[model samples]
Target: MTLPASAPAIVVEGVRKSFKDTDVLRGVDFDVPRGSIFALLGSNGAGKTTLVRILSTLLAADGGKAAVEGFDVGAQPHKVREVISLTGQFAAVDEILTGRENLVLVARLRHLEHPQQAADQLLGRFGLTDAGARKVATYSGGMRRRLDIAMSLVGEPRVIFLDEPTTGLDPEARLEVWDIVRNLASQGTTVLLTTQYLDEAENLADRIAILHGVRIIANGTLAELKRLLPPATVEYVEKQPSLEDIFLTLVGHGESVKDRS
Candidate 1:
């Protein structure tokens, strides 16, 4: 799909990566609009994380160009690092540390002036204020995921890469994290996440790119992607609403995004 003339937050072109005899990414390409959520979907071993690693500057691409916020990821690695954060598939917080401690540790490492205040503020933003002193070992899967993403935000990054941010979250918790991501985008931060969940891509992503066989087979808005499928021949006798339908209705009524930044 053709994007507008606005500047892109991410630009990837003809990117390639290989692992020994295997080619993981074969000339993948896409652009992410600034201040929007872009999702990468792929089957297992389809090179989603490899592309993310290249974009996040954790791994090098064998060929082609990648830039984040206009800084060449290959040529200006440090500059690229300055503008983005990454949350991996699993929680990155230390199980021994309390939620607040985890934030303070990350904030102090980032050299924030008021580490404690920064930690407290993040706890409140992620709805962990009441559990601030509890060790992460006691935290639920959803709570741990929230803390992980919160830690990634300690630096107020312009962009964040979430590798399945809601992997193990329950429906209610998934909605909570969705709110966090939406709130982030609403406040002008670019969010790029690789997810296996189709509903997540539908609910959160402004654009979706599907990776298959080391290449991006599809890239576009949800509507555009739907158009790629052949029209359904079967008529719907009486379509029933999904759980997500009910959830969206409830959330639409009372959701509020308190600016954490």
Candidate 2:
């Protein structure tokens, strides 16, 4: 779906951040279109998280400017907070609370009308209605993550920042979370995600920006980024199996594993 021709949902212009003697963000900048999924890619300690924190208003920038939904993050933090939701590296759902209870808590906190009904609708939407009454402590990794995102959605945020949302999940669980991200984009919510997995960005991002040395070295669709490189020489190479491939081979889903005699 096409986003409206309005100001970007999030904008960072020459945003800079530093810690003591180390510079974290060196004049980084980007524009995230409204209702689109924008992926920020970087290896560990590459300043992706720092940039995310600055844009989300959790941390202040040393120089430059940032905004969310056209509201300045530093000058109008309350307005920025009103239109954005964030889920960090770890799932924030309470283990002691039932899934339904967890969402209801956020709904009530948001002062939503009829919080319980909202919780039920979200639970059903995420395919967790049957498990809604069960305690989050008993839920699997995927279930807890789903509840965390569901909780974030209680207030109907216009923009959401997901910081490495699939960090430790297995491949199948990761795919499960991917579906939810897709659903958010389809529903017209701007999503800004930072990920270490290149494949995750390839799979989910409508636009991608690669962060390196505290800067955005490249930004474009995957195909546009690829075009910057020399033409590839077509050659065949042996495919090495990743751990997830082995995991899938050993623990098949939606189909029976083939018997290799």
Candidate 3:
């Protein structure tokens, strides 16, 4: 298939990785479009985390080439780091510091001229303005997660790698994080997310790749992926609604639905 004119935010060709004797990624190839959300779905030990680490420049691939924002991940690590941000499954906030302080620290680390101003703006944007003065230890899980994501934005990265960002968040908190991600995409940021929750991938990802056995078994939009399976009718009781209906009610509309029927 022909790709768009815009440069890919991420590009991987024949990427491979191994730990000791076990191979993690086996000649993986994919391209994530700029200013779009790409979901990488995989079971535990399917090498999703390894792929994220390699893209983030935290780990080097054993073979092949990978690039982020047109900069080679292995050759131009500094340039890749400058344009990308990575948020792991767990929040990494300083418990001793206030939310505002955490953002300020990140801003300073990124060499922002006005760290305090940038911190305040991010705090307000993430709905933590009122609790900015409280220590991170006093913040709830959701709050800390928000703070972690806010910290990643301190450098205004063009590409973000989110590995199960809402893993431990409550339903409400997950929605909040989803909104934040949507807003970032709307602002022209490229997001590459690894998620276990199929619903989360369906909700946020413009494209989804299902990784199994160290390779991508499926790659497409949700409808396209679903279409790969044999067609079947979903039976439901007239009076009793199904889980799918409930999900549709709770999560609102899915973009894939329109394309399916």
Candidate 1 stretches with Cα past 4 Å from truth are 1-5, 234-261
| Residue pairs with backbone overlap in model 1 | none
Q: Model 1, 2-59: lDDT tens per residue?
A: 2243889999999999999999999999999999999998756879888999999999
Ranking by TM-score: 2, 3, 1
Model 3 C-alpha lDDT per residue in residues 187-255, reported as the tens digit of each score = 998999998787888889899887777877677877776565434444452233222322333233332
The TM-scores of all predictions, comma-separated, are 0.87, 0.88, 0.88
Name the runs in model 3 displaced over 4 angstroms.
1-5, 234-261
Which has the better TM-score: candidate 1, or candidate 3?
Answer: 3
Indicate the residue-level lDDT of 205 in model 3: 89
Alpha-carbon lDDT of model 2: 0.84
Error of 1 at 256 (Å): 40
- Candidates' lDDT values, in order? 0.84, 0.84, 0.85
Candidate 3's displacement at residue 182, Å, is 1.0
The TM-score of candidate 2 is 0.88
Ten consecutive residues with minimal summed lDDT in candidate 3? 237-246
Q: For each candidate, how many residue pairs have backbone atoms clashing (under 3 Å)?
A: 0, 0, 0
TM-score of 3: 0.88
